[model samples]
Target: MDPSMEHLLARKKSSRSSSRTRSSSASSQTPSDQKPREEKSAPYRDPRYETLLNTKGVFLDTCDLDIAVESKNIPETLLQGNQTVPESTIFGEHQFEYACRNLQGRNEARIIQDISRLLVPSAETFAMLGSKHLEKVIESVNEGWNNCIPLTGTRPQPDYSVGFRREAFSNEQLDKLSPFIGNWLSGDLSFFMATYYMYFPFLSCEVKCGAAALDVADRQNAHSMAVAVRAIVELFRLVKREGELQRQILSFSVSHDHRMVRIYGYYPVIDGKDTKYYRHPIYTFDFTTLNGKEKWTAYHFTKNVYDNWMPSHFKKICSAVDQLPSHLDFGVDPLAETGLSQELESLSTAASSDIPLNPAEQQVATPDSSLCGVGAAKRPKKDVCGIASDCSRSVTVNHCASCLNQINAHPASFNIFASRPLR
Candidate 1:
């Protein structure tokens, strides 16, 4: 089955998780009463991979997978290692907790202010709508940001011509976009932050505000990940347009729920099946920290990354277009195709702070408040096939040996978090 179909077949945990499921091809064809309730719309970090492009090995066959748990004693050589904590600016578990404290609670105005501050100072070639236009944003969402806008920052703001909003594509627009989007047609789902030119958005984001300001169900739904993947497809289309003005590289789908934000950059990567390049997830950032306001540091880190890498992507694309007899003529190393990513950065990476502290452990700073402590938690599923989740179980990959082995393993320990048997 398609990975997307697998998600539809799987039982939903809540309402927020089901936001897109309603428009799922299978959902509309089936009675709503027969389908699982969509996950509640809560302010939480969701990490479930919904599409084939995103997920690897999901036990989809509905076959029972019962593995006898085996424990392996750590090797003495492996046990000796440096216990140094990661010191990357993008490390953010504590950062999320601190940022939340700084906001106090569901303070959307503050959130905008923080985002604006991050964007305005840089000399980057990007323009955004000013505070006045941003104010309209809170009003547009049905659940408006229930806070007054504050006069912020002394620096000169740009005469911004573009702004983004949370909008769902109308039927007409969807039909127009059908050719570009391929099999990923999600219906009427709202975009969180989208920049528009002449009412058309080339890039999009699905934002999730992590706060206790909502119900438990709301705090647990990270459904935006699925939405972001779909949006990336649209962003990819924007860059591939026929006009010279359209062939740009910043085209990407952004999913930054403040805490666990993944920016899936579309790049022409070599999928093993063919030597042809395919656009896939390239840039990712996960700052799972609790050191107050540090989580927002990712914005700064992103700006730095953009300053460092955006041009490289463009240059590489241009080099191909130039079509020199060979890269040797240009005096640029063949390996310079993806400069920054190849040298200083990773094309696909996930970063979590070494600090063992989790915000879920300390629900809220204020004792008298009602906050759903749903920190960005990663609940990896166990496979009945006993293959590593990353292993696709395709003809190309081999069966898992760990699943077949049993040394000093404790079966009960493996079952602690294990749920459904693979069918």
Candidate 2:
């Protein structure tokens, strides 16, 4: 028998025996007791109540990047073809090659393995229910308020506000520290759009608030406020534990200014140390206007909440920014650019397919033959768009044969494909 096969069989036997023991124990419980037992084992148990357990260092500091790239050999398959480059190779000008070389090395590969081992478990826990507790609490509070208010007349509104803050990581630092994170930002578009929509509203809301303050009369409101505050704190703690909180975040505050309510805050870098206070950029949000008067409002909730309240706001922000139009155009598209016509050609071809496409079409239209098969396709010929051939006859054009074949295979479909208007 093969030694590896024997080991696997032995492990399977042990797992089966252990599972049987657990099953038997569970079966022995009384019907009444089963609920409690299940609750204890339930995945939804509050992660806040659990201790801050460091799984793996998904939140890589500069030092970790150095170690991952320098001391631990890791492969940068995407950046470079080499598999034996140091993780620190990103610090070098020839980062892609360094990453590729390191990727070939066994020692460097361990760094990603270690990161995966740590990140996967923690992510699972966070996904299960660890992250939602705060949202649930907030929802409950909102529901409670709704129940207490009278529908017929103008009821007294509660004086409350919420603010958020996040720390920043430099582009250089992100490049060196975790290129995977950078890659994720580059690859995901919807993630960035959602973030933009989310924060825009909140910032707009805070702008509307514009230095207003609120007052609470009874102890009950104060207690409810305290509960909300505690829930926020717990949310932060959970984010920290899950390795989601970034060093920078957006912070928000809600207050009253006598007659009108207000919300205010800023996105700022959270000082790594305890001694330094929250330092915000000069541009803070104060959304006090609604038709030029103060009224109840909600801004981009997700972006503000994630930026301010979640510890992993930095990561989220980075991920979100990666999805932004600016980042995609500058960062990923250049490296991933095959050529103009090819990209348009791909889009033209994709549009012909029966498969439903994203409503927000990100793919650009290009000539089928011009794609380099990397990123965006090159723009079509000026002449094709009605420009005279004499305008730029000297300009060289390249097209991809494979993309042309695709277009040729479906000429009827291609002819019908209309060019989308540029934004």
Candidate 3:
């Protein structure tokens, strides 16, 4: 039943007490019904929680996240052939060729293997994730991925780092980091989104492995998109130093439940007028449902995210140095919103700073100091009028301009502060 309807039913049930009291004094009432019932009447519980009562010695329960259709149901698989690439999608023409590239001929298998390693390293998945036990799985692959991808000639080489639950992130920055339903910004590993010289990130990802991962993929996916959208906006705001936070992102949440792997993608809308920040999700798959080429396509997309690299040939760059690209191919359209207030608040803070919108020139302001001692830890600076930084006159003691001018008028009077003993 709908949650609202359930709440309405609960309200009506509570009001039934007055009617029950009135019925007790009815014209024909049974003696058995006169007595009050047991006070320990148990409340209703959701059936999903009922699994706890029927558990055995060592039990494993799971909810499958894969598309429910059986393999034999359709002749042409949705995830396999040309149908996988939508006409309006942002992907290039040759998906497999892009993902499975090698120095010489082919290494599609290498990309797939690397993606597998990224999502789940060895047998340990989210067991130690989010806790302090072990670092997130993405941290393990950062260096390898940073080295494997060829340096892009169009832009400087990137130095992507897998930062895990970093405390250095500003509260403003942390707040805007996602589409996550609950708290997700503080923990888990995330890759920086910028290329070589830049520091801010344009993309980020979250990974979950094994059966439990599939159970939480929807939740994790929502959280990942939120972060990606805001991070993209912040990155653009820093670069342009303008009102538009129009950077695009390529973010994903990868989940490998047992043998099947599900990859999710997110992209920001291209139009500057449309401030939605992110679009509907576009997703692909590997493992069972997809064939060789299809699996390669998924792997290539993963590699792209790992490298902070997007294929923008024959189009403008997304780095803001060039014209904005038409769109980006992030994956499936997710059922989530970007929570724009985080970005708005971040921008508002920048706007509220000392820099005025109409100023033709700017000046740095300093505070006046009342301190007058050499050995003090925080000796007050003598910024008489705001000219302390540029003023050349040496000040040995705190003195007004009138006294200093009176001393300077007589050259011999300067000897009073020339480290001489008082006579």
Candidate 4:
């Protein structure tokens, strides 16, 4: 070969060899050796994750409760029943004797009598006893309610919850109304109240082993009752029954320890632009220390709540459902009236306290600009990426491009409560 041509050919061969070496090195790289593509996280924080990671549980004090007051007056609904306690009824002669005997024998050691023992019953023995005794009373008065269902997997899973079945309102007219009624509530009529099967829970009970757990039980009861009252009020709000604002004690909660039982009556009232839940002390008594006369009063009160109060409350709920207008006069956003966006808050974020304990009411941004405008393509479900509205002080982000669209959109239904869930 000519000297210049040979030199050019040698340079070309060196270039090809370098290129192949670089290609081989790149092809042999492992995933660990390669740079990772950055993964963008959801914009809004998950309330449950925040709760599990950041929020600390603390027992709430009486003063820490929203609109809580100390009172001695028994609510009228609780005293409405005129039934006399018969010997066969719970806490009466026969039943009381049976309870006392059941405490004897080897189980006598488990019986909590001393105030010291009342401070800490073994495991949940005191709570179990309280539940058993209350069930007896419920059986005596449970005409067909068939409630007293225990709830689980929630922040305020009370020892007992009393609610009606979905079929209670499953009439032809209601079925027709469900579409309209369901819009005001969660998308589904079945899970509108709380869960898929339980509808319109009127009362809840949280039992504790001793006085030590009494405050915790009270907090749990307060949270549960607040949820129940809010659900009812929101239902009525949908039908625009402003007059039927929950002034009367609509929801009740029973909290008891080994020694004493406390009943609280809850109602909601409009304070300025915010809905406020009020907890009133209905009656507190020590069943163990009380005589026959006093003990029967507790039984009478329970019967009145189950038989008299609850039936009336359930009727009111049914009436509201029936009054759901067949046609829409104007487009009413169900969440608009309550200062919530059905699309902003999700079910998982509803773990916060529904009671607004602070001066600043929780607010969700319902911007004028909606992705689901006329003739616009529907937006797919997006993972919620915003602050949990529990005591949300202010909202600057009016429009979330990553969030759900308005108009028939399935937003995560968050609790409208103003504070984090009280431990």
Question: Runs in model 3 with CA error above 4 Å?
Answer: 1-115, 118-212, 237-249, 269-279, 284-286, 289-297, 304-423
Question: Could you estimate the TM-score for every candidate?
Answer: 0.27, 0.20, 0.29, 0.48
lDDT of 3: 0.28
The whole-model lDDT of each prediction reads: 0.26, 0.24, 0.28, 0.42
Candidate 2 C-alpha lDDT tens digits along 1-423: 112111111000122322343365444632211123223222212332112111211111122112212212111111122122123433233443343344342331243332211111122233345454223112110111211111111111222222221113455533422211211111111101111111111111110111211212211122223222222222233224312323222333333221233332322112231111121222222222333121112222232243234444334444544432222111112313434455456554643452222222111111121211222325553211111122322222222322232232233323222233222
Ranking by TM-score: 4, 3, 1, 2
Q: Cα lDDT for residue 278, model 2?
A: 24
Task: Encode model 1's per-residue lDDT on 1-423: one tens digit a residue.
Answer: 111211111111122323343345642443221211121222122323223213322111111221111101111111222222234322345444555456434433445455433321222233242323122121111111111010110000111111222232345444433222211111111221211111112222334455222222121111222222223322332334222212122233344443444443222221221111122233344444435433344344334333344344334333322331211121212223423223212211221232212211111011111111112223332232221234323110011111211100222222212223323
TM-score of 1: 0.27
Off by over 4 Å in 1: 1-102, 107-110, 114-206, 211-269, 272-296, 320-423
lDDT of 3 by residue, 1-423 (tens): 112111101001111322343355445432221111111001101233223212211011211221123312211222233312223221234543343243123232333343444332221232243322222222322211111111111111111223223333334443433211111111111123221111232233333334443434333333334344434443343344224323233344454432445554433333342323332234535443333334444444444333223223101113342322222222212112323233334433543442222111111111111111112112343332211222344542232322222332232423322333212
Per-residue lDDT over 1-423 for candidate 4, one digit per residue giving the tens place of the 0 to 100 score? 112111111001122322343355435532211111111011112224323211222112222333423222346545545545444433555566455444433221244232222221121232244533222122111111111111212223445566655556657546644433332221112213433335666676655555645655566666556666666765666566744663556677776654467877776665433565667777777665544345544445665665556565677787887776554322223444534455345432441343222212211111111222122212342322333444432211222311222212333433223322112
Candidate 4: what lDDT? 0.42
Ten-residue stretch with the least lDDT total in model 4: 4-13
Backbone clashes, each candidate? 36, 87, 17, 8
Better of 2 and 4 by lDDT: 4
Ranking by lDDT: 4, 3, 1, 2
